[model samples]
Target: MSNQEKFVVSRIIPAPSHIECVSGGMFKLADGCPITVISPLAEAELSATLHDTCNVYWKATPSFSFQAGGEGIAADGYRLRVTAEHCEITASGLSGIRNAFKTMRQLAESERGVLKSTCWLLPPVAVEDEPALAFRGIHLCWFPETPTWEIEKNIRLAAYYKFNYAVIESWGMIRLESHPEYCWDEFAVDKKEVSRLVKLAASLGLTLIPQLNLFGHATSSRCGSGKQMLLDRHPEYASLFEPDGWTWCIANPCARQYLTELVTELHDLFDKPPFFHIGCDEAYNAGSCSLCRENYPAKLKAHLMYFYSLFAKRGARVMMWHDMLLNRDDPRWEGYTAYGHSSRGLDELYKELPKDIIICDWQYGYPEKDGKEPDWRTSHFFKQTGFDVLVCPWLERRGIKSLGCLAKQEKLFGILETTWHWYRGSFRKETLFVIASNAAWHPDWTPESNVVYREYLNRHLREMDQDMKSKKYIQFGSVQYQINPAPYQD
Candidate 1:
């Protein structure tokens, strides 16, 4: 295989189209990373990511002569060339320039901070590049230790790989000042931190989509010290499932009013993102209360359709979990209780829900094993039914890749790798984010897993190791946010 084909970074994961080494030359960040640009926006970006590493000089026009990319470069596409005299990165748009720097950062870190002229390193080469999909992203649900710095790094990491979308499941993060009664004061993410992270992610060219648990998963907060964000203060709204668990009573006429207030409050906090995630997944054991009984499953369907219109009126596209509507009984999930409710009528759901709403089909599992393949019909089915679909996954890289293939056949909007896995680096092949980024760009490009795994870890470990040099914490960058040190655990 050629050098580009042999390397995973070069071949896929936001891969460029063409690559040709100029031979015997390179660009070094250690030598002031100057960028000549006609746009003030590019200059501002230089001041953000590169200002700390080198004396970055940004100007309106070329400071040195070099060949630039010809016209007809795709959006978020870049052309790069380097030689012994000077190195040049050029593109017709800002996204292209942003991608070029990402390539540069990857090159610098891939070789353990060395200036070797490797393709992974900014080799003396002329290349053209663009993303495989329009909406490549990561979906983060808050874990106990989800600090501000960690979230920022993840956003920066996504940008480094040229991802354009991020879905933050900010459960009770934003200040609920508009309705403090529902806020979890102890662990609610600071409102300022959310604002800061949003701004930072924006600088990196990522559009942040805010997620709020509207119908299901409201109990997620009350499970621990995250105190009564909703149900306790407003038991009247709870779905009162069988003996105990709670989801919002969808049939209750008042529920929409309550949710509208919550949605409006979240919109105000996020400055109104174009898309909103109204988590309607696995609303297990719902419609039990007298209020939902008379309405039957129709109410279950109406809850989302009603709100989809409401959110649309406010100029936002609605996104929701697709499990409840798409759930099916599979042997892999037979014995254990599945989170997705099988009792719901999938046919009726297909007929009722709004066609414009984006469906997050989170079909997570080892989809292929011993020649048996996963039932990817849900992803394919959602698209055929006239709705945009996002395939979400965790664990199972090849299986996720398969999901992407199925997505390719349908209305594939994007891929969202859910959550931050906390496994020790030594045991895993690569972090899920890296694996996900690879799948996001080219899921059908199958290779030996071990080779791709090793390549991912080698580069990732080197980047994190470099971060340890200046900071006490084990992070990829100097901790950008302030907080008390986390308790050390063995």
Candidate 2:
């Protein structure tokens, strides 16, 4: 056989056109690395998986060579060898890429090609595939009200895509204020809900970071509950600021005490190691409080420093949102979780924060915008700052073409895809998982490019059925909403 021609299955089976379109087939390399092979057979399996998984449109065609590592293989349980050379992985169809991904998991971490319930694969596949940033995480819908099994399902899905971090926001388990089951006390019967997920994430090598809205966001606070409503009654507790006819008073002593207690209470809820996300965003209405206004900048700094110190004392690190600096008035303020925002907002804060703080730059690009969508400038800036960075993409956003295959090949630090309960029907977990596995090997890929995606699909189908060819036109739609209030709705 030629150097390029290692092996090919002689017996081929036929699959549906759609199946042949999205996937080709996967190959177990000599080094045990899973490589994608494009052909008719692979596509059949891909269509089968997608038909069994989601309602999305996909098209795959063409034969392409994509692999993610040096030639690797395993002879038995006792003998394993992988070359130190960089790995190369390629696939045409989206499904083809996904099957290859599963194969990788089986090769890298699993024995007997069987994966435990909660399992995934990280890096070191290729020497050059190092993340540009250290900290990467999902920022929304982290705290879901769904059954524990579903939440755990989502967790595994996230890990399978090779994402290492996720934010458990305050939306799940506890209903927001005034919605319905609003318990006046900060009690939690579902506190144990996170136990299984926490253990599962740990086992999968993913971090589950807890996030709670600390000052502001009284949407959960009511008129009767004195603590939940903040110190609006005291007026002394609000922040001091005037932006477009509004001033938030952060000087209020009552507010400080309230936040302190809230943080302490949340800390006790988790059974795992203590890393917390203190949401300090949208404090525009703060600082105007009596005591906060007196020392404004100094006090704001003090407040953040004090809180961070508290968490540090407990052997935990605190992450705060970096939006407050956009005020233009609070230029001196620098403490936050990470410099996170869309690609458009990155350059504005590049020079402001400490180098130690990481940045999470996000973008949800589609075919209309170009398949290889992402703000490359942000990546360059993050590299320049010597700070860590991660990419957060909205895979299911409306009006955006889903380019699962293309995104996986990008040079990004890590991929963070979201699944909000409110927008649950957007994309299937299957689609997200396939794309995420693509990201694990290639972080800086652009979705607008179809060359790689098409190749991946072809390979996947070829593996499942040999008597299939390129096909097109699989349609799926996703609906997304802006958080802004509508004129006709509440």
Candidate 3:
């Protein structure tokens, strides 16, 4: 094959920032050949990942070398060079080295099918890569119906794509030891499972941030589902939430104490991450209770500040949704999803909120005018108000790209791609994950064809299955079943 063809064969997702062909023939890896890693950083995880993904063993001697530092290498950046007989990786830290090996794993797997005499042929190439946004993250929701294996798969895939953080929101899926009624009986995940997942994510260089719906989503269930996870089991606890169970009755001191305990337990279960997500979205009934209505926004502001102090005491900053901070009737946010109502004084909370709390502004649609890029006014508003902002996008490709581009251009904190309920189905193979990853890694990435991206995704999943030693069909595929069961007749 021509040199350009060989280079194209080694392409990987979230494509590296810089890559070029090198003067060398194809690098060959025989079936029994042992790869070697030379580096100051810990090599166990890197070695294991390479073996799992590329089916190559590692030795102590030669072939692969990792240099400690390199010019222009960022904390999470790496430079990789692959020649006919050897590979060299240069990075500044463990994260950079991990990222470099991740890239190399993909490159080797890309040419796994081009084997001759049981030897894989990889193209000679050089790559210098780093994420465009510092905080490349994905927000995953674990529901009662979601399987533990599925959650594990999502976490592994996010790390595989080089996402640095994963915000895990459990919708009544975590079995809180202190408050057993908070989760469903049969589906609740125990502490052991939670710890396993957390350690798995950490081992893969991915941070798992814990999330609890402190204000809204008090039922721990979607509003439309007509289910209240806690109240449905313990009717006596109804007084802690709004009459409809849509939001916590923050005015109640007992309710505050309950939430505090829950937060403390869940936070500790997650190993007390650097950031805690206090879901403060869709609280349409936030101050509807008589006691809460007495002072309205003052009480609301105090409620938020209470948790801010709670988490701060634990050495963690808070993250909350931005819907309630922006006025819904404002002309500037006419087409956006702003839930703040001026009549209730919720529209001005932004002015009083602490600057350290990261505002997660979720814009799920293409809000830009025709032929123009999105202005991301909401994110800019938060930043202008002196608060760090994380632009959140869900499922929409245009919105993901637009918000990601805005985050990069404005130098905002980063992008958090939310995959609510969609992560459980065929959407796993959809372009959303790849697109979001690429958007966070390289905002200016050229969109690849869906077919081509799908191939990359499939190969990644296959490699993951191999690493996991999965035996069942449900372990790795677009869908768990070939056909959908008839409604109520499984």
The CA lDDT at 104 in model 2 is 38
lDDT of 2 by residue, 247-330 (tens): 223355554565566556556555435567766554434544444445455555666666767777777766554454343333
Q: Which candidate is the best by lDDT?
A: 3
Which residue pairs of candidate 3 clash? Answer: none
- In candidate 2, what residue range of length 10 has the lowest lDDT sum? 9-18
Top model by TM-score, which number?
A: 3
Residue 195 in candidate 2, Cα distance off native in Å = 2.2
Q: How well does each candidate superpose onto the true structure, as a TM-score? A: 0.79, 0.49, 0.92
lDDT of 3 by residue, 102-181 (tens): 77667763345545344455568888898899999999999987788888888888898899999999998998877888
lDDT of 1 by residue, 102-188 (tens): 665554423345565322234556666665566777786554356555666667666666677888876555566556655546667
In candidate 3, where is summed lDDT lowest over 10 consecutive residues?
56-65
Which pairs clash in the backbone of model 1? none
CA lDDT, candidate 1, residue 47: 44
RMSD of each: 5.7, 13.9, 3.1
Off by over 4 Å in 3: 1-10, 30-68, 110-120, 425-429, 448-451, 487-490
